[model samples]
Target: MGIVLFALLLVAVVLLEVNDSFLNPQFYSDTLRDADIYNFALNDLPRSALDEARLIAPQYIDPSLDENPLVSAGLTTGDFVAALNRALPPEWVQDMVEQVLDEPGDYITGERDDFSTRIQAGDRVVLVVEEIKTLTRQADAYNLLFEQVIFPNIEDALETELPFGIDVTAERVAEAVRRVVPPEWVQANVEAALNAVTPYVVGETDTFEVEVQLSERVDVALEEIKSILLESDAYDLVYDEVVEPIIKDALGPTVALPFNITISRVEITDALREVAPAQWVQEQAELIVDATGQYVTQETDSLNIDIDLRDNKIAARDVLVRLAREQFDRVANDLPACSNSQLGSLVTSGLTSLPECMPSGGTAIEDQVRGVVSDTINSLQRQIEDAVDTALLAQIPDTLTFTDQTLKDQLAASGASDNADLLDDVRRIIGEGWTYTDQDLRADLLDFDSQDSVDLLDDVRSFLSDGWVFTEQDLREQIGDADPDVLAKLDDGRRIFKQARTWRFLVYFPVLILVVIIAFLGGRAWWGRVAWAAAYLTISAAAIWITFGPVYSALSGGGIDRARQEAIDSIEPNHDFANTQALIIDKAIDTGAFIIDGFAAGVATNAIIVFVIGMLILSAAIVWPRLSEYLYK
Candidate 1:
């Protein structure tokens, strides 16, 4: 009994803590918060309807329903009671009594006759008592029927219908629509209507009422606004600026597109192919940019762009105007063959409609090509940095810092005096030179054995401070001669390294304290604690693994890659290489990590609930006998 009571108390405390502290502002931000982080989660984003329901659900219990206006106006508890009393008059009460006492013969009189002598002085009192009991029973029946049948139905109907009267006005609807639409769309539309009536407008003040009546009409009005802006010619310039780039990215290579590709086709050498298959594509793009850039630079050389603007170079806009003119000159003078009939017209048209955001009087084509070149180069640079980082990490010692002194000590202890020169050669190659052989690396390690202990407390401290994980002993064992199995376990354990220690306090530590209390409070009775703790940890860990691993991996590049492949396959159904969407396919492969993380996290949380239930049953099965034995002993 004591154990059961304690368990119940502990459960109550945990529930209280979760509800009053953890859930309100944090975990239960919305039904959808956790779900948004990953899929398969309960959509907890509180809608207006859900909030209203929560407020109203508790009020259902009150018979008076005083707080609710509609309920107060209708048949509440007081009103119902009053109505019942009025319906039952003196004659109605007496009739109820006669019905309860009805008989073919005079049975009431017979009983009365038998008790006549005893009740002679109180005959009037006996008749009053019979009448009271009969009326009481009838009132009770009427009250039960009214409450259970009629009142609940009425209350439910009111609850279902009341919130509809909370009107969403026209102003509110317009405000919501304005906020929901993307900013770029709004800006583009506004620019298009430069000379026309304002693109945005509010109709009647009762926007919500209008939505209820003619919502489709509002949509048509919005479309008409957009169409009017398009007719004004102001939108033509802004639309072209935004749509051209979007089309280029989304549609891939197309002859129908306005832009012409004059790639300086180059022969692919064996050396170039070995280094980069995309080299031809990159070189061609760069050549096109350089040709245009040189032409503009020469043509604009004599033209003085404001020296103040050049010298100060305060804003991007200041540099852009000058650069555009330079690019225009470079394209016309340096690349004679690059000029097209459309180049002059496009530049003139583009500049004539330049917004404050657009650059003026320069080679727009060259500027765009330059941006493309810069993007491609930047991407290549990042790839190089990533590759170098991977290589550098593989090379570094996790525990011991390398130096001449350490190297000399290692060499002396190895007892390879004949190969002292060989040691020097290996060190010189790996430590000082750009390249190293496998033999050289292995020979250097021959001197390092299991017995050597290197202190790495500083490294561990740094890792901890930086929200990473490394321990002195763990580092030593990994870098030194730890057993392969031990190292593997340590490696597997390192998964927790990236977790924010601060978050652990908020999410896991409270549950941990409860686990400890449950396990140890009853003198080494660990069954319940072990089972529940293991279950919780398993679920949490699984959630982390799925969120950060396989699901994340699947969602990352995998989904994108699949989409790309589908796109590519459509392009050329039979030709394997030609059928894939090259750009999207590349991106999918590159960005797999992020997508997989979100998917995995959601799956893991759902799995935890199922696992916890199983653990509870197992806890009961294992602990019951042990508990009984402990009590008996």
Candidate 2:
């Protein structure tokens, strides 16, 4: 019967495992549905709708259109042809010019008048028309080239590339010069330009170039530009490292390229969608467990039997419960005792309220009683798991597998039958931690000797905490999933917890009874008996080390290094954090509380286990009188 019962227990555990796998948070069902719906909408949308909206909305300015000098001309292909035709001289003017030149004698009426003189007026009219035609032709050619190549290339380039190194423009250069040059230089330019605008002649192209002998002022402006470039590392790097090389390669000479790049800050809005749905299903399950496991694990009143026995006395279970609650009340009725040590009265004050431990009247009280017990059990389990996790987390190389192993080890560790098994379980959890995420492995990287590195880790954690918003949306669009690591961890944690709970439920009562018996009759030499007394003390000390020594050491080491480096690097060194450690004494206090809690739970549970073993020994020691009678017969 015992074997059958054990087999049934095994089967039930297996079934629970299967159910957990399917129903957990990291499961992919909901996300898959969402993905399908999103894809359908995208496929059904009209192609032209997006384009028409963009045209109406004018999302961004066309840099090419803005850069063009002829925007105001507003000339189209048709306008070019009309302008060309209008520029041609009238047929009558052309004919008159020809006739006068061919018959110079008739036009002059005198031998002294030459052909050149006769047609000079007509020649002027023809020349004006010809000049107009030439200008119109040139404009037409420019417009054709702009349409066919320059405009298209600019548009395509804008779409395909990030802003390059250099963006030189006349105004940008002028702005650079204005920023640096003295007031005297500006006054000189104003005076020089004013002096140069005299006796302007028509049809004199050379006059414009000389007017802008503006080169002398520009020379001074160039010095200001060079100075600015020299001051900016980014500018110097772009000019010397990237642009200079590219220009030298193409032009067959080393050349300095001037660039005036406009920098616009653009952000990629990441959403939490990239996590695979399979993984997500797992994460979701884990998250649910993380959020609620403590409540469920700690619910004591809901235990199969609401029974408590103390001091070798057996009364109604409810009566025992009342006695326990009363004891707790008496202890907490006054302000908690305080010591003159570190974080002294703070912990005492924090513990003054025992609402979680207090048993009110009625169902709430019943529930609270149960909750406290269950929470106690869960707390013990958590302590064991956390110890294993911390040790393993330090050793783990990856984060993805770390959480997975930690979850598994937590379940198996709870079932530990002896000291060896418990220690083995701890080691297994650490070994398994090797498989977790890069984030998990890198958690200690924050303990690096640099605040900058620590800050980077913080940023990553903050990003995760913020739900990876940008990636989430993209995942929604691309594959239809949300980030699932947290959810998966929660799911695995819950399943392991539930398994552990089930085992505890099956064993707790029998174990408690047996422990009671052993405590009654077991000899002093029983080490199991010794375990009950010392389990908490050992665990409590370990917790203290974890909370105070290790944690403090990790944080302080990094802070000190940063202070030292900054001191060395400083021109006028100020060692502000030099001797001021970042250590918080409160962490040690918290550790103390944690140790107390761990001790309470471990001692209580082990007492039951030891009691069971003690009872068996006592039974053997009593020598079953019936067995002696049978032996004599």
Show the lowest summed lDDT stretch of 10 residues, model 1: 203-212
TM-score of each: 0.15, 0.15
Which regions in candidate 1 have their CA more than 4 angstroms from the true location? 1-196, 199-600
What's the count of clashing pairs in each model shown? 41, 59
- Tens digits of lDDT, candidate 1, 1-633: 234333433343334333332323222223223223211111111122222333453256465433443232233343333333344333444433333333201222221111111101122223433343334333343333334444455444333311102223333334344433433443333333321211111111111110111222334434433333333332221212222222233333331200111111011111112232244333432332233222222321221111011111122222323333343334333432324544444445443221122122257675664344335434444433343233222222222122233323333434434344464444333233323233333344454632121123223223323323323444445645856776555444443321322232344345456545644553344565565445444454444445445655666665666765665556654332331234334444433433334334443443454346545655674778789899999
Cα RMSDs, all models: 43.9, 59.2
In TM-score terms, candidate 1 sits at: 0.15
lDDT of 1: 0.34
Sequence-dependent TM-score of model 2: 0.15
Residue 429 shift from truth in candidate 1, angstroms: 89
Q: Per-residue lDDT of 175-259 in model 2, one digit per residue for the tens?
A: 4544444444444443443333211111111132212223334345445544433333333223233222322333333111111
Off by over 4 Å in 2: 1-73, 76-92, 95-98, 101-117, 121-209, 213-633
